[model samples]
Target chain A: MSTQIPKNLKYTKEHEWILIEGDTATVGITDFAQSALGDIVFCETPEVGTELAQGKTFGVVESIKSVSDLYSPVSGTVIEKNSDVEGSPEKINSNAYESWLIKVKVKNPGEISQLMTAEAYDQFCQTSA
Target chain B: MTLRTSLYQKHVDLKAKIVDFAGWDMPVQYTSVKDETLAVRKKVGVFDVSHMGEFFAEGPDAIKFIDSLVTNDIASAAMGKAIYSPLCRENGTVVDDLIVYKLAEQKLLICVNASNIQKDFEWMNAHAGKYDVRFTNKSEHYSLLALQGPESEGILKKFIPNLPSLEYYSVWESGQTIIARTGYTGEDGFEIFGSHEYIGKLWDQLIAAGVTPCGLASRDVLRLEVCYPLYGHELNDEITPLDAALAWTVKLNKTSFIGKTALTDYKPKYKLVKLLVEKAIPREGYHVVDENDGVIGVVTSGTMSVVLNQGVAFARISSDKFSKGQNYFIDIRQKKYPATLVTKPFVQGGHK
Candidate 1:
C-alpha cells in the first residue's frame, strides 16, 4: 500500500521525515517506514542535548519482527525528546508523522534543502517496494 | 527458492509480512502480531500450517515400530486418540517433538515438524529394521488449517456437522479429512487436515466469513504464553526431553524406545523453567546468569506477552534449586535485570 507523505516535509532516504520551523527540526519516521516495521513495541531515542550528525544513528525502533536503527535527518543537538513515544511506541505505528521523536536545533540549515521532496520520496518508496 | 504453501497467495493478498521460516515462505503477521495474538485469545484466528509434515506408519507392526522410535508409548493409545511425544535419538536428546495418531488397526499417523521432515523420515527409515512397518511421507499430500481461540468450536461447527464436539487430544476422520482437537496454542481449537484444494476452499470460506487470518508470529506468542516448547528453541538434537522438562512424555518403562537406555534414572543438570522478567524483554540466546555473573543457562524462547502485558521468558537453567520465587538476572544488551522463576501457562487459555 502506498503510504501518506505530506508535501511540506523533507524526507531522508532512510525513511525519516523532518519538519523545519525556524532553525528547529522535528524528526520522525515516515508512514512508509512505520508500516514496514509493523507494530512498534519499544523505541529508544537519544536523550535531550545529545549531539547528532546527519545520517547518523540516533536511536533504535524495535517491533515484533525486527529492530531498526533510527537515523538523524540533519546534524544538530537534540533539544527535546518525546518521552511519550518511549512509554508507548505504538504511537509511531498508528501516527508516524505526528509521533516526532526529537526536536533538534539544526547545525546546518542548508542540509534540510538537500533532502528529498514529497514527490521524490513517494517515487523512491514505490521503487524500493 | 523458498517453498510456498497453497494459501501463499492468500497471505500476500492479506498484506501479511512474509518471512522465510524453515525454508518455507510463511506469513509472520497480517496486520500486527499483537493484534493477531489478541484475536486468537479473545475471538478466533486461523493459521496456515501446510508446512508441517505428516507421515503414516502402516502394516502389522506399525504401533510397535512407532513405540520403539518415540519416547511416549504408542501401544496404550486407543483408536482415534493422539499422543504427544519426543522422537528422540540414541543419546536421549530430542530429534523432534511430534504427535502420533492411532487410526484403524495397525495404522498410525505421525505429525512432524516442517524443518525436521526429511531428517525424521531418514531416521525412522534407518530404524525400520525387521518390523513389517511401512513409512509413507504424506506431507505434500495434505494441507493443514488450525482454527484457534475461544470461538473456534462455533466456527468449526459450520462445516463439520457430524463432529458435534471433540475431547482433548482426540481425532475424528471423515473420509479424507481429519479433524483433531489439538493445537500448539493453549486455546480450544481444531486442526483440520485435507488436500490442498479442499484446504484452499476452506480458507476462502473462513476469510469470507471475516475470520482473522493469523500468522506464525502470533502462533509462537500464544504457544509461549502457554509454555509449549518449540522444537528448535526448547527441544533440539542436543537438548534431551528431561533437560527440557518434558519428562512426562518419556515413558522409560516401555520395552525399549530409541532413547530409553540413556534416559534411565535421568537427572538433568539443566532444567527448563518459566521466568517473568521485570521491564526488559529476553530473547533467545541471552544469558541466564546469577548474582556473581555465573552463566547458569541460556534462554530458549521468550516474548513480550500481549495478554500479560509483560515480558515472559523460558530458560534452561541448571538444577541448582531456584524454585518458589528464587531470583535471577537476564543479561540483555550487557545490562542485567532481576527476574523471578515461575510456573507455566503464563496466561490462562482454552474454554476448558
Candidate 2:
C-alpha cells in the first residue's frame, strides 16, 4: 500500500499497470506487484507481433523462490517488448513503472473502461492485503 | 502462531520477510534471495539455524546405542569428529538425516531437522530400550549459528582465535560453547552452538563485523547448488538413502545397523538426478518426461541459480526408465522444456 500508484495510469486486478498514449499503451507491473514478487531474476515476455488477450497470461516473471504469470491487461498486438528487462529482470524490482514489459496497439478500447483508476487500484490492493 | 527463535527480533529489525518454515517463524530473506546467496558465495554470511533440533546421547553405551540406529560407522568415528548419517527405519526408508558429533567416547551430540524433532525422538526412544544410553532432547537448550563463505574464517577468527586448528567436520569445545567446522552452504565455514544468551551476543558481534545475515531462502539455493540433500525435499520417510543417491552415507560393511538387513537387499527404484533446465524454471512437483513425453519422475527441488544464471533442479527419475545419455524434459504448466541431466554440484563451492 505504501508503493506508488501513479494517478494517470490504468490498473488491472492482477497488479499490471497501463500507460496509454494515443492508440498504443505501455504495460508493466505495479510497484506493489514487484515488491510482492521479491527479486525477479527472469522475465519471459511475448515477442513483438504476438496477439494478447485481456486477462490472459502473455508471459511469466520468475523470482528466486517463486514464479508468477504476467497477465495481459488489454487485448492488442505486441508492438514492442523490453529485451533489457528480459536480460536484467531486477530492473523491475528497482522501478517497475519505468521497466515496462511490453507496448501494445489497442484492439478494443472498451477494455480501458474495465480497468481501475489509481485510487480504485489502491483501495483494491489494501483490501487484498 | 508459529515459534520464534532468539534472533527473531533482529531479523525483524533488518526488515526480513518472514515465513513459517517447519512450524517456526523464520526469515526467508532480507533484501533478496539472490543478494544473500551471492554474498555467502563471495564474502561472508551468517544464518540463524537455531530452529534445528539438537539431542544429547550420553552413557556407557551411548556410542553403541547411537551406532545401532544410524547407517554409519559411528562407533569407530574418532573423537572430536562429526559423522553425517541417515537414521533409517526397519524397512530401509530414511527416518531423518542428521549429523552426529562425537564429543567423547560416552558423549555424543546429534542434530536433526527442526520438523523431524518429535518424530525422531520417539523413534530413537523406541529403539533404545535395550541399550543403557540416556537420550536427552536438548533442542530447547541450544541455539546454532552458521558463519559461512570464503571470508568466514577471517571474520569468525575475531572471536574464536583458535578456529584455524579445527578441521572440517570437527567440533571444538570452548567452555559451554561448541564450534564445528560444518555448514550446509558448501562454503568453508563453522557452525557455532551455545545458549540463547551467548548466541545472541555472538550474532550481534558477527553482524557488527560486517557479515551478511542470510535467511532460509538463500540457504536452500546454496545447498541445492552444491547438491546437498534436504530432509523434506531430497529425502523423506519413504525414500531410502540409496534411492536418493546418498549411498556414501550408508556404510554397508558395518556389522549391524538399523536398516542394514533391508538395505543389503534393497534395489533402487528411483535415481536422484540433477538437471540444467532450459526455457522455464522448474518447480517442485513438476513432472519430468522422456522424449515421447512419457512421465518418468517428479522434481523434488528446483531454483534459478544465481551463479549459473539458469534454472537447476533435482528430480527422482525411475531407475528402470532412465538410461545413460538419454534425453529428458521437464513439463511445466502444460509445456515440456528440454532438460539436460547434469552431474552433481551445479556450482563450484569454496569449501576447503
Please state the CAPRI-style docking class of candidate 2. medium
Which ranges in model 2 have alpha carbons more than 4 Å from their true place?
A127-129, B162-164
User: On residues B58-81, what C-alpha lDDT tens digit does candidate 2 reach at each position?
Assistant: 999999999999998898888999
Error of 2 at A76 (Å): 3.6
**Model 2, residue A28: what's the lDDT?**
95
| Best candidate, DockQ | 2
What are the TM values for chain B, all candidates? Answer: 0.97, 0.98
CA RMSD for every model?
2.3, 1.7
Stretches of candidate 1 off by over 4 Å are A53-56, A107-115, B265-269, B318-326
Candidate 2 i-RMS (Å)? 1.0
Best by lDDT: 2
Q: In each prediction, how many residue pairs overlap at the backbone (N, C-alpha, C within less than 3 A)?
A: 0, 0
Q: Model 1, B3-69: lDDT tens per residue?
A: 9999999999988989999999999999889989999999999999999999999999999999999
